[model samples]
Target: MWADMAADTRIRRTGLLERYHATRNFLGLDSCVAASAKYSTEDRRPLTKDILFPALRQVIKTHPPLCVGLANESSSTAAFTRLHTIDLSRIVQFRDNDSLRDALESQLAEGFDTDADLPLWRIQVLGDNTVIFAIYHIIGDGLSTIAFHASLLRALRDVPAGDASPLVQTPNTILLSPPIEDVTSVRPSLSTIFDEVYRLFAPKYLSSDRKAWSGNPVPMGVNGSLRTNVRLMSFPAHEVTAFCTMCQTHRTTVTAAFYVLTVATLSRMLAGDPRYDAISSTVAISLRGAAGIPKDAICDYVSAHRTYPPADPRFSWPAAAHHAAKLRTQKSKARENIGMLRFLLGQYVPFFRSHLGRKRASGFVLSNLGRFDASAVEGTWNIVNTVFAQCDVVVGAAFKMNVVCDPTGALNIALTWGEHSIESDFVESFLSRFQDAFRGLLV
Candidate 1:
C-alpha cells in the first residue's frame, strides 16, 4: 500500500511538471504591448466604475493565463498550479501629457522590478475610462498582442468563452540533449566573444553626424522629453507576398532578405570607413519543432544568429541572397549545438550577457513572428490599428527593425531606436529605403 501511494504521487508530480513546461514555452516568446489612451471631458460622461471595471474583470477572468509565467524547466506551457495577481491600479487624472510621460518613464526605469517568481500585469488609468496597460514581454509577442486585442473585443461583444478558438500552440521539445556537446559548440569564448560583441555594439557615432529631425518632437510647450515615438506602417499585403515569393525562389526567407537589404541601405546611408564592412544583424530563430523537439516543451529556445552582408558596393541581389542562404545554413547548425553552447557559457562565463551597445559586432535586429490570424476577430470592436512596442536594448546600439506578419497576410514593419541616438527622420528614411529595396528585388 505504501509503495502504491508513492508511485501515484510520483506520477502526479510528473504530469504537473509536463504541464508547467508547456506553459513556459508558450509565454516566453510572447512580446508585450503598453497601451494608453487619452479621453476628453465630454467622453468621460458615460464612463462608470461598474461598467469599465467589470468589463476589465471579465476580460481578466477569461484570459487568466496571461497573468502566469514559466515556473521551471518547462518552457512554453501554462500551469495553473502557480499563479500571481497582477496589480491593476486606477489613477484619476494627470495635469498634462508631461505628467503622464513621467509616470511611464518611472515605470520603465525600474526594469522588470515586479515579482519575478510570479507572472505580473498592470493597468493604470490616466483619467476616466482612459487607461494604460503594461504587459510583460514574457506573456505575449507583438502577434500575441493582436490576439489579446481580439480577445478583448470578443469579450466586449459578449462572445461565449467556449466559442473562442484556442491560442495557437507551438510544440516544445528539449533539443539540448547530450547537453555538454551542444554547450561546447555554441559557447562564445569569454575574452574573444566579449571583445567582438563590444566592438560591434558600442555607440561611436553622434546624433550630430546625421541631420537631426523629429516627427512629433515633444509638441511645443510639452514639458517632458519624448520617451519614444511609436509609428505604424503597413505594406500592401499582396505586394509583400509577391516579394516573399521572389525570395522563396532563392531559397531564402523574406526576413533574410529584409536583413540583407537593411544592412546594405544603412551602410550606404552611413557611408564611411567603418560602414563598408559587413554589418552584423541578429536574427531570432524559433526552435519550435526543430530537430523533432516537441512544441510544448520549447520555451525561448530562440538563439540569436548574426548575418554579415558583403561589404562590396557592387554586391548584387543574387549575390546577397546566396550569402544569406549560406548564413542561414550556418546558423541552423549552430542552433543544433545550442545546448552545449549554453552549458559552456554558464560554466565558464556566467555573467556574459551580449552587450547590444557594441556597434561593431551588432548592427540591428530583424524579427519575423511568422503568421498570425489578423482577421480572426473583426466587426466586434473597432480596432483603430495594431502596432508593436519595441523591446529594451542597449542605449547606444539598440536601433531595431522588426517585421511581423498576420494570418490575413498583413506585414507590419517598425523601426525602434535608442531614446538619444537617432532622430525620427532617420527611421523614416530607413523605411523608405526598405520599400525601395523591396521594389528593387521585385523588379
Candidate 2:
C-alpha cells in the first residue's frame, strides 16, 4: 500500500548484485540463490501468502531491485512466479531423501524466461513441513535473503492466522536513499585506479602459477558454462563452541577464522609452487549499517575487504586468525572507504564491472553471516538448518565460500565455483584437504 517511489523513468539503475551480475553477464555469466529451510509437524504455521506473502510483497514494493515491472523490452526482468501447487505426495513418488531433491528438481524444470511473471520469486512446499524459496541473484543476496526469510517468520508470528488484513507490513527498517556525503560518481583521487592501469599495461613480469588456475580465463566463450553445486560441511556443537572460544582467545572473530582457513588452504595448495609468493582476497561486508541501507531492503550494500596476509613463515591457524583480524581492521580504519565510496559512485558509474578479472581472485572471496537469530522463527516454526547457496561465479577465482553458523552453533560453509574452470573432483579433493587443515587447527 505504499506510494510509487519518485524518480526518473528511464534510469532503472541496478544495485550491487545486479551491477555485478550485468558485468559478469556481459562477460557471459549468470547467478541465482536457492535457499532452503526445514520445519516439522510441530510447526503448525501456515505456508500460504496470507500468512507471509504480504510482508514479502512489502519488501519488493519498497525495494526497486526486488521488483519486475515493464522497464521497456530492454529491461526484461520479472518479479513473481506462477502459483503452481503440486502435491509431491501424489505427483513424483520416491523412496527416501532423494524424494526431496526430486520434488525441487521437478518444480524448477517448469522453468521461466523474461515473459514469466511479475516477481521472480517462488515457494515450493514438499509434503508438509519442508519449504524451498528460490530467487534470482538479481533480487537477493545471502544476507538479504536471510533477513527476508527471518522477517517473514517474524511476520507470521506477528500477524495472527486467518487475519484477512488488507495491509501486510514489514517492520524491518528500509533505506530509501543513499547518504548525502556520497561522491555521486566521481573518480576522486584514487591512485589504486592508476595502479590497476599500470598492472594491466605492465609486462606479464610476475608469474602467477598458471597451473594454479587463478588467472584471466582464455575465454571459453558460450562453452564456458558455470555449473555450481553446494556442499554443506558442519562442525559439531562442541567443536563449534571450541572454535568460537579459540577465536575469542586469539582476539579475532569467527569471520576472521574463516578467512584464515581459506588463506591457509590456498597456502597449502600452493606450497610447492614457487611462482606464487602471495595472495589477496575480498570478504563481503554488510553496508546496512556502514552505508545506512535498511535491514529489510532487498538490495546489495556489500563491500569487500582486500585481505592480503603477510609473508611470515610462522603464520598459521591462530596466528593467521590474528593476522586476518589486523587486515580486516586496516580495511575498516582506512582513510578511504573503498566499498561505500564505490557504491556511492556506482550511482553514476558502474565500477564493480571494472573489477572482473582473474586479478580479482588474488585473495578469492569469503562471506560469513555468523549465526542467525533463530529465535526470530522459534517455537512451532523453528528454523534449524539452512541449505543456502549461490551460482554463476566468476571463473579462475578458484572458489567462492559463504559461511553461516546456525543458532545451535553448528557452522555451515558452502564452496561454489564454475565447473568449466575447476574439475568437480578437484573441488571435492581440495575441500577435503581444507576440512583437514581446519581440523588440524582445532584447539
Candidate 3:
C-alpha cells in the first residue's frame, strides 16, 4: 500500500500517453514515441558529467514523462510499477553517429523496454559534436520534450556552474490542479458521434499506389509489418524567416502552412486525383500552456487532433493561411483535444474497427514545435544546425512530419512514414516538388 503511494509520486495522473501505451500493449504494437533534439555546441569537446548532470538531475526531479508508468494500469489492468533511480550513466550519454543511429533505430524498433522501469528518454553526442536529447512520447508531448531541453540549456547558461547543488529527489510534490469544468460530463452530441462515424469510416488518405519516401510503392506496412523510414530537410534561417513572414502576412500558423503542404504533396504524388482533394492530416497540439500547466512541469498533454484538409489545392499562401485559420478555430471549438481520448474506454479500438472495413482514423501527423530559443545553448555550447523528429509510429498515424526552427531562424523538418506509404525516394521527390510549388507562391 505504501509502495503505491510512493509510485504516485512518479505516476502522472492526467496524461493520455499511457492509455495509448496500454492499448499498444494489448494490440502488440511498438507504442513508443521518440522525441529528439539535435544540437551543435560551439566547443567540440566531449560531453562530460559536469556538462550534462545539471540537466539530468533537473529532469529527474521535475519531469514525470521520463518516469515510465501508466496511472490506470492496475492489478486488474496489467499492473506495472514506476521506474526508480534512473541512473544518469544509464539514462543519458554521448555517442558517435553510427552508434547514435543504431541506438535510435533499436529504440524505435522495440515494442517496449524490457526493463519496464527503464527511463524512456536518453541523451547522445554525435561524432561531429551535435547533442541530441530524446524522450519517450509516453511522458512528454512534442511541447514538453522540447521545453525540457530548452530549460536544460537555459540552466546551463543561467544557473551558475559551481553553485549548482544536488537536487534532492522528492517526487511527491504534486501541483494542485485548478478548478476546471468537467468537460467529459458534457457528453459528445449526436452530431459529434455522427462526425466520429464519418471520421472512423470515410477517413481520407493518399492512394496506396502512391510512392513511398524511397520512391518505390509503399511497402505493406500493416499491423506488425509497418516498417518506417526517416528523412530530413532543412531551410536556411533566412528562408525560414521568409516563410514566417509569409505566414504572418497570411495570418496562419506555421503548422497550417505545413499541413496544407503535406496535403498538396500527397496529392501530387498520387497524380492529382480529385480523391486527393481534402486529404486528412493530424496536428499534434500541446495542451499544457493553454491548460495552465507550468512550463517546468514534466507532464505529457499531447493530443492527436484531426484537421480539415486544405479547401483549395491551388497554391496561394493567403488561401492556405485562411484554411489554416479556420482549422485553428475548429480545433478550439471542437474541444476534441481534451476529450477525444475518452473513446479508449470503448470495448473495441481502432485496430478492431478496421475489420468492419472502416479503417481506424490513421492519417499523417504534422507536429510543429515552432521555434526554440537557441541563444542559451550558444554562448559556450554553441548550436549550429539541428533536427527534430518522431521515429516511432506504432500508433494509428501512418506518417509523422516534425517541424521546428531554432533561434537562428533555421527551419528543421523531419519526416517518418510507414513503408506501406511510399519509398524513401518518393518522399524526397515529393518534398522537392512541394518546395518548388511553395517557392512559386513565395515568388
Q: What tens-digit string does per-residue lDDT give for candidate 1 at 1-443?
A: 22422221111111221232232222221123343332223223333443344445556555543434333323222222233243333222223233444444443332332225434445455443344445654433333444455555445456332322222221121111221222234444465455455544556452221221111111122112224444455777788789778777777777667766776777667666552455545666644334343322212234456555544433255765775676566554545434333333223211122222222234566666655443434433333333344534322134566566644576766555545445667777877876776677666
TM-scores of all predicted structures = 0.57, 0.72, 0.78
Looking at model 3, report the run of 10 residues with the lowest lDDT sum: 209-218
Candidate 2 lDDT, tens digit per residue, 127-156?
444566665554566676676667555554
Over 4 Å off in model 3, which ranges? 1-17, 25-28, 38-41, 67-84, 98-106, 158-187, 198-227, 272-278, 294-296, 307-313, 337-340, 343-363, 376-379, 391-395
TM-score of 2: 0.72
How does model 3 score by TM-score? 0.78
What's the ranking of the predictions by lDDT, best on top? 3, 2, 1
Please write out the lDDT profile of model 3 over residues 352-398, one tens digit for every residue: 33432223244577888778766643346545555566644443456
**Model 1 Cα shift for residue 346 (angstroms):** 5.7
Q: Which candidate has the top score in TM-score? A: 3
- lDDT, model 1, position 103: 44
